[model samples]
Target: MTEHLDPDAMLVAYDAQLRAHVPPVLPAGVTAEHDGPLLRMVGFDHGGFVVPYRDLSGLDSAELDALIARQRDFFAARGERFEWKLYGHDLPADLPDRLIAAGFEPEELETVVIGPAAPLARPPVLPEGVTLREVSSRADLDRIAAMEEAVWGEDRQWLAEGLEKEIAADPDSVTVVVAEADGTVVSAGWVRYVPGTEFAGLWGGSTLAQWRGRGIYKALVAYRAIRAVERGYTYLQVDASPDSRPILNRLGLASITTTTPYVWSPAE
Candidate 1:
């Protein structure tokens, strides 16, 4: 499927639809600011996130430096950390270096992979002792956070809070699912249907290390794809990690570009 896909065309649509999109509504405590040449999503329990799709190629170094500093100061003055998302195809080739020089630390680079959803909407094939189920509740969200903590060996309490906000903002736009073994959470993932677009984003497919390589991750993806198709969404998207990129590639999605988060903190 990927062989027939035009990466350039996919990126064109992605930029036009997802990148250019500004949220029409946000839940309480969250707000969007359309600063000059930038759109910043702020007040998340996790922190702020700058939309990755802006064009900065026209700005010279000093102009760009001022722009970057403005964002850093905006968040810092609020005593918060925020992220500026940079895509690999973004012009002004030295942008990353400039961001680093300005004290923004770069996070891991992730591939932005996408493909039509219809092809991935197959019936999931789960291994023995595991079952897939859609969930909605603070309890379920807490369970997912615990599983995520075990998967990454870190505190994930914020995940529960963030998911709650997302679900509250628009329950129809998001679907959360978990894979369980003997009633214990083993793997999980979610789908968020991008409003007014053909895309549905698959996020947070984390499985416990003990359960890795057991078809659980792929099954969760299949479940999300099925949900996407049923919701009238035509395509699927993922910010694929190195571990997930190969699986998504085999599942028919191909990377169109890469995105790295350049983070700045008010606190050292």
Candidate 2:
């Protein structure tokens, strides 16, 4: 006989499995801090918490409220931007309203897709003059960061620092691939393979306007997929934007769910 799992229980199991498999690359100064049963980070940029509500098995309302108050104090002390990455299924009894009352603002939602890595190994062909290469050196990382900032309209310091830490912690699990033509990085992406999990995540797939629809992104995906398979990961996951959704669909990945990021800023 099969056992039935409650929806909330199943979500908690999934969240724990994913988090255990892939430890988030917490920013510098952010240390793993716990409040009661809540596992979170504190003392980092404006301070935030992971707040695994799905796994809040032993917590009472008072404990939960204290956790929120702690987070609020942490943010107020530093006067920096704060973020809480909450999932749709993680809606506890009154999370949204409480967060809003505490000054958190919601951001756009993105699809979370997971599937076997085989399809990614067979990415579509790239247009002429476009070629894919894995970046292993600091100089290559700098180039990739520059291209990313150019395409996404942001500074590269955050990404550069994050990548540097990842490389220092476990170089083999992270791969940065860039698509270049005519001596410029027109397209780029990266993947992080969790050491013990079946999941490998693709991130930072940025391409220049002129380079879209030429299969460069797909090729980059393929490159990362190949890397994931090489590292013994069976599944590839991506928090995809609408622009990449159709291509990922073509590659046989299904949308498992959505992730929405809520931000709290000092200015607000």
Candidate 3:
């Protein structure tokens, strides 16, 4: 049954429909620019994100070297921590190696899971004393960020800041949902609806170790899926980490491809 959903085709659709079609609707102060073939979103000061697309099959080693240099120089000049997103199926199979040679550090490789949101929208039965809530107030947002920090073992101030701006700009486009148990946020996640596209993004799903098997994560997915459907999005896409991949697979999302973010930070 799943074979009918061609992973290659889905990947093609992702690059074309999502990456090429709908650019990110960034926060108020950010600026998105088209520098020839690259789609660059800047203004985060600390860094930015870049999307590069092309058929590398025709380029020689020299040309490939030059292209990589150009990308490096472009971001380096800005003194930012830029991430160039690359997919598993992208051409010139050695592209990963080239990125490493250009001072770009590869982050974790994530499986790109995507599927219709309907199957995931059914609310799961939560454990007793657990409740789900769509975060609205600053207090709720802080709670969610705190939960994420505990889960990831890092200061997640960026998560809180980004969510605050997103909510302030367009609350409907960003849904940050959390599962509260006994007045404490146990698990949290968010969904981003990109207007002008059929896809929504699922991000920041993290659960405390004690709440692992209870179904809080699934509830978070369900709530976000419901919100995505309400916003007229057909598909939900997530860059699934090893821990969440199996769970999301059970929810019917296909792991169509792998993606790795090669990050470049300007020299000090």
Top model number, lDDT: 1
Q: What lDDT does the true structure give each of the candidates? A: 0.89, 0.71, 0.81
Q: Write one digit per residue (lDDT tens) for candidate 3, span 194-253.
A: 777778999988899999998888888988898888878888899999999999888888
Q: Choose the strongest candidate by TM-score.
A: 1
lDDT of 2 by residue, 1-268 (tens): 0022233443343475675232555534556766554566654423454555454435576776676667766767777666776666664647767677777788888877666786567654889998888776777778877887887787875666667666765677689888989989898888987755667889989898888888888888888898888888877778888888778867777666677767777764
TM-scores, in order shown?
0.97, 0.83, 0.91
Locate the minimum summed-lDDT window of 10 residues in model 2. 1-10
Which regions of candidate 3 are displaced past 4 Å?
Answer: 1-4, 21-25
lDDT of 1 by residue, 51-131 (tens): 644568898878889988888888888989889889989878888998899889999999999988988899999999899
Clashes of each: 0, 0, 0
* Pairs of residues at least 3 apart in sequence or in different chains that clash in candidate 1: none
